[model samples]
Target: MFRLKTMIGLFAGALMLTAGISQASATELRIASGFGDNHSATRALREVFARKVEELTDGRYTVSVFPNSELGQATEMVNQAQSGINFGVYVSSAFYNSQVPELGVTNLPFVFPDRETAFKVFDGPFGDKFKPLFEKSGLVVLGYMELGFRNVTNSVRKIAEPADLKGLKIRLQNNPVHIATFRQLGANPVSIDGSEMFAALSQGVVDAQENPYSVINAFRLYDAGQKYMSDTGHFFDVIVFAGSKSMLDAMSAEDRQAILNAGRLATEAQRKFAKEDEAADLKSILSHGVTFTRLTPEEREDFRKATLPVYDLVRERLGAGLVDEFLADVDAAK
Candidate 1:
């Protein structure tokens, strides 16, 4: 069998294209994502990937995206994808970090300077090194996209320094690394799904929660009666499009490239969604009457200084070389 790379953009393209005339073949792949309708991040990926895939594959392959967890919740989608009962899952790295400890590296506080640096590190060294860790666990990572940088919104009074974080029970995703990072930083971390977080905060089950502006704004955490907010890019959420390794291996080379291209298209759209929405999202919260406490550089450093030991945590599990490779590449990219 000739590889598609050799067939593309040549006279051989005609011969290569003739092999796929089966009407009985699988026409659609199932894709699950957790973003609520109208949310920027989820909207970008769900709509863009589906459209790009249909175009790229010339309608032979379709991706039916389940947005708003209509099929099942995002966390459960992983196991489904792994079983090949589902084709792919749109999941946050935070959720998978507990299962594949190497991913805990992403949850480390103050790791990347900002959102751009975060993605650069992930797309280059950090994500490259960590992609195989998923393969080892029977999954193939299609690609990484941004959920935007997370910030803290609390019902507590204004937060200005590390001491301000004390005793606030912030809801975190159910993962050890998320809990550990918050614990080390002095907040009482409450583990829960993002779907439940706004209500948990509203009813006093939690005093605060952390998420990207898109999420904070979309979930209407501010409307839930929160008062104070902090920009704590403590960690970056790399939305990973992943699925069964074997299923991907079973794909025809063209289908494999189509899936990969869709993931990239989704990322390009997701990044645009995040970048364009950042300013408006935060401002929208203010209009909803949530108070903002923008952290000065000194305050941010205070938080970073306290949580700096997380390097040991990441280096121990993910290898010092991994972090070094990540840091060097990100520095150059920045």
Candidate 2:
């Protein structure tokens, strides 16, 4: 009986050693985003990428996701990825304008007629042009996740024309292009972070804000006294899924391929989720008693014209005529 017990102890020790080796062999990656844990982007990363990457890499790699800006703000997360610390971040193309101003081209108002056109452009050759731009800033562009078309929400009134937005204190992301566009439309656009948006809207710190329907619903902004929503669809938001270039470069070819494949899967999942959530989100917001307005074609055109000077503003900051050339190319391709 004593000899049998000793043999069992030896077997348990060997099993423990094997488990330790297996755990140490897997490379764990950290992915962070500002979206809530239940947000589609977070779900895609956790469900689609995290679950598949290990299998895709034959158990060589795994992922951990941090949502709700737990890792840091979007800008801080981008900086972490740039430093090659095995970090991935879901940020906006508008945020990239700070690192590479020309990337702001993707954020231009009314650039794409609709989400379908925007996705085709981003998934095609046009999106390829920005890869090197991202690499130059120490990031590997994994995929472009959809944020959908941003619209306007305010407590003041329904915004049907450019004049309707005048003098309203609106909260916008800290993107210069966005600030300039809103300034042109005559609203007082204040740059603020996402985490502070709910309070800003609730406390009268800002009377208006703009974001995708999903985002507006996710943060429960409608409950914060925002009474009106207009489907301006001014800027089609693109969430950039990215990783540290150096870390990606250091990986073996097979591992890199696995990462890319996982990213593609995550992007597909996010886009699908965004599409499905939009209508549901809008419905939920309506249930909160917020009035909705679908912009008439002429009213949308008024916004388009009002913000046209933003192209020149972008040109002056990025380079002369870059915006015009980019838009022309996109139009010709379409």
Candidate 3:
């Protein structure tokens, strides 16, 4: 009994010592984002994180955000973070799918039922599953923010029915799932980097594209040679902030807390801004002379049916069990 009491006291002392040391060692951290400086995600994170991180660290540490390609492209940012050149990135899971294909299961077409359901799953089991994958790749997933449900936008015509997308060359992310979806819909899906999208659409390399309201507005897709938008919310996209596992490991506890605190606060702020952006997307775009096509129930069904192969191919690539786990989350959330 005496030795056990002494050991407990010693463990308590060690914990206190570690806490004190953590409090003193951290200073500041840099965060990288792909969203433009004025974008909702970037602006909200930079503004909210700076204040929240300092407070969480008791001003022992701080966060500085670099938005747009200020630090670099999303893929480049992830590579940089993984290599421990810098810290995290506000990137898409589709971007991470190049390194971790199973993670892309979240981005499958018509998978998520709504935004609320999306937040729950990504913040719950599904998000947890990707953490180790990110860590194995030398990256650490902090958490997720929002990009919201995506709608198809085109210059050629409004897409009220699946037939409308036929023959339209659309810009797609470099992923098999997205490629399969567009191809099944009878459109030629052209894989293009996010950075190249504007120019590609402008030069007519692709006649249409799809993204969340925030993204379309941030890059001025409406003015960038796009004429019509479709309210076909086919998929949900989320921006993930993943840090360098090596860099995080090197951080003192206070600094680590600072990064996570900032991330949580940023998620809230980004979500609020994203909600507003989505609410106002159609009205705002119409003011710029853009047209929106709202699909009827039957038309939407037609759109959904066209992408059946997306499910088959994605499940095959992800394997039965992983795909089942993903669909379970999707169903639970739905």
Candidate 4:
């Protein structure tokens, strides 16, 4: 009995010591994203944000990065953050549109003419105006990272013109604008979650899909039997880093500032990484035997024109007032 009691006492003491240390030292936070660890977004979170947070906080806080939907899908991760179960999650702007509505303004087809224009809008006054939309949805926007311009990948046919998309079934991000846009372009658009995209393409459940080159390579859509890719540059996307307001409010002011700084630095790094990896990813995808097709400026304008009707639906869904305000921002960016 004495030996058992001594062991129990020591174990209890150790537990108490651990609890005390945990209380006094750094707070640990889990950050999650739907993309793979090899992805630039995840790499930024792991290397830039996570490291910078620790450095900025002077070891007062540490972050654990979970990639490839290890924690959950994007929607589930957003719920986790909103409920304060996790510190942060990377979410798509289109996903936010499903909740906030007005956020879909960014999803308008061909709104951003190029990468430079996108950066100006998202990092400048446009980003500032849009960031507050998350607060109403139980999230606080940390910063934005590029997902790059989306292009078409197909096992069926090469898309050189809007007419070429006529009979193909294309998988799109779960955004109404994307679906409507493709539908108007005469292709059947199927809204599928990112996790299920590969199998859908592999089994021919969908004849085609559109995404950035980074996504095409990261997800290995080529390995899934995708034979052709088009540089349509139809839509440019940015991933939003969002946090739980309650969780952030629980932090010390200094710690909160550290997180904000870390997020801003990570955004810059993530954008740079995404842009830098584009040409290489395109080459990597092509080396796998997929035919690469680049749309001419006239061909791209054809697509732009075909999708113009999409803006009316967007304005109706997101409200004309919000759409006008965002268009002004888009114009200002140019």
Candidate 5:
């Protein structure tokens, strides 16, 4: 009986040692996003991206997702990822423009005629040229996901022409190119953070704002008294999925490859979700009694023409050579 009790004690001790080793072998990567939980990008990150990473890594790696600015605002979250406080971040391309001003080339109004042309440019040589810029800022480009084309929403009136936007105070992202584009169209552009947008609209701090249908619906901007929406499609926005270079470098090659593969899959899935959700999101927004306007080709051309000097403004800010190359690339892609 004494021998048997000693053997049982030894067995239990071995089991505890094994459990500790198993726990220590697993690594948890935290990914942060400014988008709300309901946003398709957030959903893709949680469902497709996180799941694939765990599966591909054979449970050696796990992901923790914090959405809706739980980690921090978009730019702050990007800083966390850069510093390795968070393992990765999914943020707007516009947010990265401060660090890589060349990225502003992508934010130029009407640069991409449609989604297909945009994808071709980003997935090909143009993207190859820009990826290094992001890497220099301590990020490894995982993949680019679609944020979709931006549309105008307002409490004031329907926007069918450039003159219709005259004197309207529109909330815009803190991007110089975007602000310049709106200013060219005769609206007063106010830079407000995403978290404050609904309140700003509701309280009349701004009469108008621009975002994709997904954002307006997810944030319920209609409830904020925004009764007019126009399919401006001014800028084809992109969401960049990036990992910390420092943190990724610390990982084994096999582990790093697993993360990259997961990111690619997640980005593809996210783009699909964004495209699929747009029509439904628009229908939902219209159901809220928001007036909608779909600009004809001629009307869109007028807005595009009014903002033409923005291209020159971009050239002045980002250099004519780079902007010219980008335009050539965009034209070639088409």
Candidate 6:
């Protein structure tokens, strides 16, 4: 009986040791985004990125995603990721412009005439230039996802030409290039946080706003009294997937690779989803009795010409030489 009891004690100790080892091998990571949970980018992060990370890491790592600003607003979340408070962030590239001013080149009006050209530039050398800048800021650029082309929406009337936008109060992101573009187009660009955009529009704080179809649909901005939408395609926005450099550096090589691989897969999935859903989102928006304006080539050209000075503003902020290189690269990609 004494021998049997000793054997049982040994067995229990071994089992406890194995359980502890298993627990220690598993890691949990947190990813944050300011987009709504239903947004395609958030969905891609949760469904594809997070899942792929777990699978690629053989269940050794798990990711928890906090969407809809549960972690904080876009800029705050960026700070958290920089400080390693969060493992990663998926937010607008515009949000990173403050940290890497050269990144604002992507936000230049009408730089990308279509999604194909935008993807080529971003996935090519032009996009590669910003990786080191992000690294200098203690962040890793995992991948760039599509936020699609930004369009103008207003409660007052259809913006068929640049002159139509004159004197209208428009809510815009806190992006200098965006603000300058609208200002040059003769609209009163009011910088508003994304969280406050709906209220500002609904309560008449702003008469107009611009965003991609995905954001418009996800936020249900149509319900906020926006009665008109035009395909301005002023800016083709990109959502960046960035990881905390310190956190990633601390991770094992295999684990870091797993995260990067997951980022690539998620980015591809998101771009596809956003492109496919654009038409559906537009249809849904118009179903709410919103008038839609499809600008003719001449009309688009007029708006584009009016916003051309925005390029000069960009060159001033980010040197004429670099801007020239970027524009040349854009042309080559096209």
C-alpha RMSD by candidate, in order: 8.0, 2.0, 9.1, 4.8, 2.4, 2.9
lDDT of 4 by residue, 1-334 (tens): 9999999999999999987786578788888887887788889988999999989987778899888888887788888888889988886777776456666778888888988888787778767876676776778888888888999999987889999999898888778888898999999988887888999999999999998898899999998878999999889988988888888888899999889999999998988999899999999999999998988889889999989999999888878888888888788878
Give, for candidate 1, the lowest lDDT window spanning 10 residues.
17-26
Query: So what's the TM-score on candidate 3?
Result: 0.88
270-321: candidate 6 lDDT, tens digit per residue: 9988888899999889888889999999999998888888888888888999
Rank the candidate models, highest TM-score first.
5, 2, 6, 4, 3, 1
Evaluate all candidate structures by whole-model CA lDDT and list the values in order. Answer: 0.78, 0.87, 0.81, 0.86, 0.91, 0.90
> Which tens-of-lDDT digit does each residue in 1-334 have in candidate 2?
9999999999999999988898798888998888888788888999998888898888888899988888877788888889966469997777776566777877888888988888877887768888898899999888899988999999999989999999999999889888988999999999888888999999999999999988899999988889999999999988999988898888899989989999999999999988888899999999999989998999899899989999887888877766676787668656
List the candidate numbers ranked by lDDT, top first. 5, 6, 2, 4, 3, 1
- Quantify how close model 5 is to the true structure by its C-alpha RMSD in Å: 2.4
lDDT tens digits, residues 100-211, model 3? 7787778788777688988888888778988898788998777688877888888887778888889999998776777788888899989887888999999989899999
Error of 5 at 282 (Å): 0.6
lDDT of 3: 0.81
Best by lDDT: 5
Q: After superposition, how far is residue 3 of candidate 1 from its true place, in Å?
A: 48
| lDDT winner between candidates 1 and 5 | 5
What global local distance difference test value does model 5 have? 0.91
Model 6 TM-score is 0.93
Model 1 over residues 112-133: C-alpha lDDT tens digits? Answer: 7877788777777557877787
Clashing pairs in 5: none
Off by over 4 Å in 3: 1-28
User: How much does candidate 1 score in TM-score?
Assistant: 0.87
> In candidate 1, how many Å is residue 90 off?
1.2
Please report, as a residue range, the 10-residue window in candidate 5 with the lowest summed lDDT.
91-100
